[model samples]
Target chain A: MKNGAVLTVNDLRVYYDTPAGTVKAVDGVSFDLRPGERLGLVGESGSGKSTMALALMRMHKPPARIAGGEVLLDGVGDVMELDDEGLRRIRLDRLALVPQGAMNSLNPVMRVRDQLADGIRTHEPGDDRDALTARIRAQLARVGLDADVGGKFPHELSGGMKQRVAIAIGTSLSPSVIIADEPTSALDVVVQRQVMETLRSVQEEIGASVLIVGHDMGLMAQIADRMGVMYAGKLVELAPVHDLFTNPQHPYTRLLIESVPTLMAKRALASIPGAPPTLINVPPGCPFHPRCPSAFEPCDSEVPLPTSQNGRVVSCHLYPGEAA
Target chain B: MTAFLEMTNVSKVFSAGIIRRQHTVAVDDVTMTIDEQSPSILAVAGESGSGKTTLARLLLGVIPPSSGEVIYRGQSVDDLSREQRRTYLREIQPIFQDPFESYNPFYKVDHVLTVPAQKFQLAATKQETTRLIHEALDMVGLQPAETLGRFPHQLSGGQRQRVMVARAMLLRPRLIVADEPVSMVDASLRATILESIRRMKQELGISVVYITHDLTTAYQIADNILVMYKGSVVEAGSVEQVIRDPKHPYTQLLVSSIPQPDPSLPWGAEGEIAGDPESMEVAAVGCKFVDRCPVAFAPCAGQRPPLYHEHPSRAAACFRYDDAPTLEGENLDLVFERQLASQPASGSEEQAAN
Candidate 1:
């Protein structure tokens, strides 16, 4: 909470109990989200960025367990230590999650109005019907949706509209922190731009810190103030948006940035040579060392601890001596 | 020389619902051609429900176009002989979007390769078939030993898609219609897969119709670009011309909306998502993009604009180029400025109200 950090995650570890062994989905990832900051988590599929988001929300299922971590919210205490009832009370009030798939998250049977009202009543049950209805309309308007949209089911709306409804529900209570997971991945380019604009406007109005998780580096670069690069469940590098793109410290981050196809220039994409490592049997030292171009002697044998300086964190043998 | 493949005025209509039939024009009056002599990558870029997939289906001969001619090697695909049909099927291959769903999970990955080999009679003996499979796999950068005998689920998404490319390459097809081939694969692996496709065009002398919703990928590998909107081609030109200086309003929106991977280039003013195209029934008379187009005019609602040739190589389906009568072209900016000045704002508002 000090230095105006809205959320602080320290040494977070989320493990999935598979039949083979313990798969480290999220391994020792740590970062602080400042108030009103838009932080992006960029990684490929199975890189554990989504797992980190779920673990932060304490929404991980039975097979997936949070091994150890401290998700400390500013006003609310450590979320990892909260019980079922305590967690429920603070869920929509302090922290909110806008899930990956809008169709899956929104209740198909319930009208959009009732769904919004239901979330409101769960947190603050004293509001009468008229007040609740007004609140629902306001929430709908906040996400640039017409009030009549509340009358329609999830099936009736378009993909972008459904995503907006999801955003409306997540921010109905004006939570301190909003976690959007691939919010516009399924939408068209035009619609995706509109949706991201809506999200940015809403976040600015509420002044809430946002943690967006997705694989699209272009999208992250456009929206996020700072970005964290994850490889094989590890947070390899965290820096401001410009620094991350201009001078990527981690080899994986550099390759990822280069690999992203751009409209500016038609150059041969720098594809990483090897396949993404499997979580169940990750390589012995740094997970990215095998695929890294600049990997050296200490990389394959020793796990590089995270080192922090000037608001940037990097975990690699390339940058040694300054340990966290 | 005759073009390898050409679709002239292609249109496919599908009627859904039982009691009251609702017709959807999936592909509307589309015309494209690829030369047999010049191997190139032609990108058909569009959003969902834009009919790019329907166009791919038409090219693959999975479903016949309701109207228009699909000519393969200067012969009507519909009028091909039995032997010609077999040749057509083998020559033009399709690589679909989802690699996981493309294969049957119960069968090992080798089945996809062997079955195609046997059906096409690419190899005579069992040993010959094995060698072909191994050779195809090697061409895609997949180690034959590691990739073969594994189930589709066991191989990574990138690997499975590569296997699909290798299968298509097995027949040495003249043209490959790859529909969103890299969309489902992971980001890191996309470059490898696209590289393989590009390699096919360069090395094997195979043309490709690369269909995708992502323009960045299209701009990366495609030689020419066709931007589609609601089953209609809004713009068609070389990748550099279309992407750098988009003519049509829709193409401009698409180019501007792409989230560039640079902090220096931020998104502009907020854009509003218009009415859902699926729910709003489009009339058969006018332009399909008039509802969402920013620079739509009074003429757009009255009649569909033909593809006006702005330059020798570039064309756009918009009224702004209608005044440029000659192929040499006029100052199109003057025409655009004049059109915008004369347009009434209430014209679009009235159309929306209707």
Candidate 2:
């Protein structure tokens, strides 16, 4: 909390109380966001990447609950301690969320400009309407959308255009922190590149800390300054973008990197065996042990603690001499 | 050499509205061949409305082409009888884009694999059917026991996609029309599905028509590549030859537009490559890509270039290659230069200087 970090989460745990049992979506995960830095949260489906983002924003529903965590937003105090009113105040003005599948997030009947205006009016009351409108127009332009799109309904715009509008809405308030969940997944390759670039440039322009949750490593590699690789409900590796891609430490991280298709490497793609374990009843010991090619006896019996090496933190027994 | 599946001038047009005033040319005059021996992975690459999906559907005989003919095993697809059509379907299977949509959500994942076995009567008993399902599942890297009873939602996106691949493999089809098969799966799991397709092609001699907008994945898995723009093939060749040295301007743009994984390299900010939506709305005599073609000449706006032979195993629809004495004589540098010239003076000069 005292450091220059924009956001810091410590010993975070989020669970879902399903009919099956208590599902540990995010268990004992921790990471930090520096001011104006872009941190990518990457994992396969059900890797707790999205869950971590939701928990940080305290957006989980009745069935899904944050078991324990300390989400400290710099200058604003702990996010977990905030009530509904405090959370609402923090949402648009301080921390903005670009939800996943935002193409469908907009109301079909409402004009996009009105939606943005409504969001602003609800959060920052009695603000200059014209000034806010001008800001919205600039934001839309920044994301490669024209100002005329503000008058159109959600259904009138293409998927890519809608996503850009979503970005415009999220960044309209100039929040201190922005959490974008799978922002480019629904877009085509060309639009995907455009949207990611826009998101990165916009974040830089605003000087706001950004958290991107997605499964696409290539897209993440393009924007992320640092990246966190999650498996099941734990943070397996957290390192600079280059380090994660070039010299990944965790077995899961290595596997994930290897599995990504790129123009440079044309070798036979290797898939990690078995699917991700269900959160309802995650496997004991190391969550990734079942799929980890290098997993040994200790991996099935003991959980590895995150150990730091050269500014990178890795939670794996593969890093020898690292304590659990 | 006689190809296994050959589509000649195949086109599909769908009409909407009460007056039928609007027409969508989903597939337009596409001609390609899948050879018999040493079958290659042919990728029909394009964005939405590029007709790649419609072309796949046409090739699979799910929806017949409105014009021209699809030849399967030396016979026209339309000429086949009911029994012959069934046989053709058995030989040529389709792997849809969404695995979740491919199967009923209520049914277990194994049901998809089991139906083919039952229909083909390949299994004498329930045990044999189960065995066949397991074998197919194993081929696609899915454990039979783990996936058998699970619903679509129960399995992860990767697992569900693998199951769909298993279903496709159950019939032992000689050709697969995989329409953006891995697009929906997680990026970490996409390579695995692609690898399965590659393995199926190598081991089982199954030819795959991989339809996708992702040029990177196309480069990874395809042997032969087809670059489509507005329902027509602009370029076609060996993946290595085409991707490494793209002949057509459209292909070049696509290849360059692919975002490099290296962060050091600048994101190629060649202004938005705008395809003429209006051109696709109405049939035209000229090239479909003329508006977007940076190297478009006067002739490009007047006449649609034919898919002429470029090399021993390559063909492209570009005026640049038309006058070359030999396909190798075609000047790639000159095309790139012409393209640079066609761009607005300010941006091109700045880009060139950079």
Candidate 3:
């Protein structure tokens, strides 16, 4: 049972303090990532997948706080226990994040090389200008960018090129873990494919563990080794990419898979009835029970904890027992 | 014979910039028609800068085409009187990309439904307006109780989008130009919106000009799909024919790029680089796609290839066809593998350390 993954998150709970009530953005979520493995978290907009990723990085401020959880990176210790200096060092050296859009990440005014150099200079303060430039050029190459791209402003580059620069910036320090938040969602389909491909090769090249957050299951199928389904601020199911797509156990997961239309086939899309429940005052019992098809008496009363089944896990009453 | 809706050699150019002005050719010389006999869905699909958005505006008569004429009912759109223009605008409704923008944040959700019903005279009195609103909500499968009186902020994106579709439906427009209507909605709820659009065409007998960048959704509802790239349409045919076997290299890339939810098919890194689609000079003589095309030979850089009819229902614009324009240079083999296409642009990638 001990896979010895580099990062293990257990009982992670992130809640926002709203005037109305506490919004449980990420409640009772747990997952582990092997050192060079890719993990994908897919959910609808308000499913709290992005909040969970932000929580993983301990980026919660006053409004949003990690109420209870333990984020244990193999050598970095519990992220919750980290103080100001620890958080800073760990964030810069141990973890890197590629935010929602690459366009948002880069400083439009600064040269691409300078921006990357800024990343290295913060961590490796002793490195000279030439050394930083060399490192920046090297990182650019790692993300399949040209050396000349160093001098150009962010506006001069295409969206895909800007995205590559974002990747390079994220991976510049050779961080152990990289969290990509919907890297390709804003792009054209063709460009989206190309950006995803770059991320894949870069993941392979650097051998860094990746935790990607996006709503596109089709994209996850291509990018991740394992996939997790998040709904109503809960991690509903976790399985290998192929297994999750082929044999989704949870009713919500099953319906979620059916809802997405794939290019390979044009089977009828069964739209999941109703929108996602609000995290602030989620429905009692199962958050998904209101929209769940196989809602029995139990599903409407008691919350289902994630139960392991067939080398994977799902949080639903359907799979109540342990794996056979 | 006059077609029901005709766009004859339509082209739109914009000259912008202050110090250094640059002309942008958003739509090239494109001719298309939707027949009156068959009320089928015409999907104009392409990536950004493909001019699908401009074409939608032109169709809606929001902007006049720089050269071409848009004819409706055997009359030029330009020649239509002010009264006729209003009627034309009502008949050819448009569904914008963002649903939230369609409705004002200040107004109640049902207010959008009321204005259209009242303006178009679908209802006589207050009671009749409410009835029409309820009926419109029913058509799009929205509960009137839950949707009515709620502000735009309260309604979910899918619900807001549905309300927009319902609003457009109440008018009973002959043709609806839905430009990326489902793009903002969640994936789980996308089918419902697409289904609603399909039902409008099939059950209501309204034609649709569905403009989108997503091809799978296009395939699901579109009767005819038009593939556009860099301000020009490269391929046009039935969904089954064009998607099954794409003739143009750009169409092939767009088709192959669709991320089908299958783990077996790996995301290949090497693909065509869609280089600055916006920066391509407006006056360039050669094929616009030659820059990113995988099978670009000598002749492709000289002249634009005419649209070659591959079948009665399908056509493609490429030099690979047998009816290619004669050139001084020899015509090479028309073969382009996606993997090889990515190579031409990447020029010796720098090696990464372990």
TM-score of each: 0.94, 0.89, 0.93
Runs in model 3 deviating more than 4 A are B268-283, B324-354
Residue B279, model 1: Cα distance from true site in angstroms:
6.1
The runs of at least 3 residues in candidate 2 whose Cα sits more than 4 Å from the true structure, single-residue gaps closed, are A127-132, A320-324, B1-3, B124-131, B145-154, B269-285, B295-297, B325-354
The residue-by-residue lDDT of candidate 2 on B129-150, one tens digit each, is 8888888889888778888988
Taking the tens digit of each residue's C-alpha lDDT, what string does model 3 give over A1-324? 137788989899999999999999999998898889899999999999998888888875669898898989878779888898888887847888888888877888999988888868878899877877778878888787889999999999888888889888888877889999999888988778767878878878878899999998889998898999999889999999999988889888899888887666666667998888878879999999999889999988899988886669899988787731
How do these models rank on DockQ, best leading? 1, 3, 2
Q: Mind giving the per-residue lDDT tens digits that candidate 2 earns over A1-324?
A: 756898989889999888889988899998889999999988878888888888888987768898998999988888999998999889978899888877678988999889888887887777686888886687778887779988999987877778878888888888999999999787766667667777888888999999999887777777889999888889888999988888888988887777767777678877777677878777788988888888898998888888888879999887754432
- Evaluated at residue B194, the lDDT of candidate 2 is 93
Local error of candidate 1 at B191, Å? 0.4
Q: Write candidate 3's Cα lDDT for B1-354 as tens digits.
A: 776678888899988999999888898877777644445677889988889999999999999999988898789999998888777877888898898988889999878888877777766789977887887789899999998999999988999999999988878777899999999999889999999998776666667899999888888878778888878878877777788778888888887878878888855336465554334454388888887777789888899877666565667788887474322121011110011212321222101100
lDDT of each: 0.86, 0.79, 0.82
Instruction: Categorize the docking of model 2.
Output: acceptable
Which pairs clash inside model 3? none
Candidate 1 lDDT tens digits, A1-324: 767799999999999998889999999998999999999999999999998998898998879998998999998889999999989998988899998879789999999999999889999999998999899999999998999999999999999899999999999889999999999888888788878888989999999899999999989999999999999999999999999999998899999998999988889877999989999989988989899989898888899999887778999988884786
Q: Which numbered prediction scores highest in lDDT against the true structure?
A: 1
Interface RMSD of each: 1.6, 2.5, 1.8
Between candidates 1 and 2, the DockQ winner: 1
- Cα miss at A295, model 3 (Å)? 1.5
lDDT of 1 at B134: 91
